[model samples]
Target: MHDHEEHDEQDSGGGAAAPARAKLFLEGRYRKLCRDLPQTVFYCPECKGHPRRRRGCARCEGFGKLTRDSVQELVGWVAGKAFGTRKHKFHGAGREDVDVRMLGEGRPFVLELLGPRTFQVDLAALEAEINRRNEGRLEVRGLHWTERQRVVVLKETPHAKEYEARVAVELAPGDPRAAQALAAARALVGTRHTIIQHTPERVAHRRADKDRERWIEFLSVELEPEVEPEVAPAPALDAAPELDAAPALDAAPALDPAAATAAANGADAAPARTYWRVRLRTQHGTYVKEVLSGDSGKTRPCLAEWIGAPCRCVELDVTAILDEHGGAEEVVEPAPADDAPFGTGI
Candidate 1:
């Protein structure tokens, strides 16, 4: 009986020593091709992601997500199918807004696969499938093996991002005032400036309400007339083969056809809509949208303040992400012409 008791104790100890679960880390870079998609799938805000009853939830319109789909879901689904695991986590270097598309080589990310039944995977094939499955919405490149610690480095590293925003000035479209403002904005380019920015109102709820100072290393603004409905848009502005020595204006950038149509006619019939294609480089975590609108005076030295007009960021795109050593994980391909597609511009 004594020996049997000792054996039972040993069995209990071994059971307790068993591992909880297994996890696999796969790292790569991905481009978020649409402005309307989120980086992760979220539960219904009203339901707190948990449903009281089966079948459907009240919030999220029973879709179980605030949006239709996210980069996380898109990639995870395909990866899960390949790896034979239903549970996974997406870790991104940094996330862009739902309304902002990520271009360039794409943002660095790691996908953690839990309880993957299979370890063997062709990363190149997986990357191709991810891109092919999502098509124009998302693409993953430079897929490689990585460890869990990589997620930490990705999150903690301070990165710089280059961005493009299409801003609409309040001035009448044909007004010469547009030219003066454009020049003023252009002259400020290549001149480094610092500004104090409070957490923007849109994100204040989730972010700490505080002031942060950031530097704008380079900036350029160019004006373009809104293409009339009956008229076709001009050829897409050719992106420089390389980043320019100085910030150069892009008279043509991507625009939302619906928004452009709405603003096509101004009140005075003086060409209602004129857009400023703004390209800027800034430190990570800068609230770029607030940089243009001043966030109701929370952001100083804003474009709105300088031009003496109200401005808003109607379209935003992340053109590049750079490491501290100026190494880019991927390169940027030239964007297609204006008529290419809704969110194809880089």
Candidate 2:
């Protein structure tokens, strides 16, 4: 009986030892598999020499150094894993000429960083990193955590813009016609069908070689003294009793159409001559440069064609952008009813 009990105990001990040895072997095999796996096989910058199941590898900090799509994927993963949400969008203010540098305040813009892992980010440090990486080429400011709706609003809103450009012109000297031409340009209003051809010189690579119709409304123009100025009586004199009081001489009758047409035809006989400083307000995506240049005769009734001279926008500036579909009309105040008593209902 004693021998049998001793045998049974030995059998139990052996059974326990077998499992211990197997566990050790399994752990060793797992560690070897992790170590021997090549980092390139994973193609993850952060996962080199790390277990596949690890939360994140210290080497790349979970960011794979690859295409922008990779960055976006990693951002999505981080947001989902850390914050349990997903929201983000990119917004750029007034795009550059692709080659042109946007100087001064770098254009006012707002980026809505939404549903981030942590809205409370070290924005100053992030800005520093971006600036450092870009070498001052691109900069960002007012980097605050915001909502997704704000991003939509930013994209939709028509932000006012300002631009400065130098233009070349073919102009004559010592002619009064230029002043009239500039006046006509400034007087134009509303939408005008101006067709523009996409040329290989400027925008062929990115844009399709097609024609686009755009609207341009000239806000104002300033012309050089190519002609002498004509002086008229001051407004105060016109208002004085000497000439004004004569029963206000009913407003002059409208001119006959025949006479008007004759005057217009005569006005076009002279050649235009002057450099102009033109200011305009227009909708987004209207190619101001092409409008000014006539785009090799693509623009109809253009500044060049209108004046019958090779004309260019000597200087151009975008003063404002009018929102076409802004909102409901403003509520106007109702005029008080005549003969209504004070504090009485109408």
| Highest-lDDT candidate | 1
Each prediction's RMSD to truth: 15.4, 26.7
**Per-residue lDDT of candidate 2, residues 1-346 (tens digit):** 0000122223455464222110000000000011111111234444533445234655545544222232223222333333334543334334434223344333333332333333233434444454454343344433333333443544566543333434444655555665566556666633444445454356565576666655555545555544466898578855766655545456768788998997888864655445666655444565667677777876565766665567765444333323443222222121133233322221
TM-score of each: 0.77, 0.41
Q: Give the candidate number with the greatest TM-score.
A: 1
Residue-wise lDDT of candidate 1 within 1-346, one digit each (tens)? 0000122222355464433456777777889888789998866666666655313765676666788888999999998998899998999999999989999878988898887777666666778888988888999886666667778989998888889999988887768887777777888888778999988888876899999998775467877656757877676678536655655578557797776776775433553556889998877788899888898899998988888778888999999998653346443332334234322332
- lDDT agreement of model 2 with the native: 0.42
Candidate 2 matches the true fold with a TM-score of: 0.41
Off by over 4 Å in 1: 1-20, 53-58, 231-271, 324-346
What alpha-carbon RMSD in Å does predicted model 2 have with respect to the real structure?
Answer: 26.7
lDDT at 258 for candidate 1? 75
Question: What lDDT score belongs to each candidate, Candidate 1 first?
Answer: 0.77, 0.42
After superposing candidate 2, which stretches have Cα over 4 Å from the reference?
Answer: 1-90, 98-108, 112-144, 149-167, 189-200, 224-274, 313-346
Candidate 1 collision pairs:
266-272
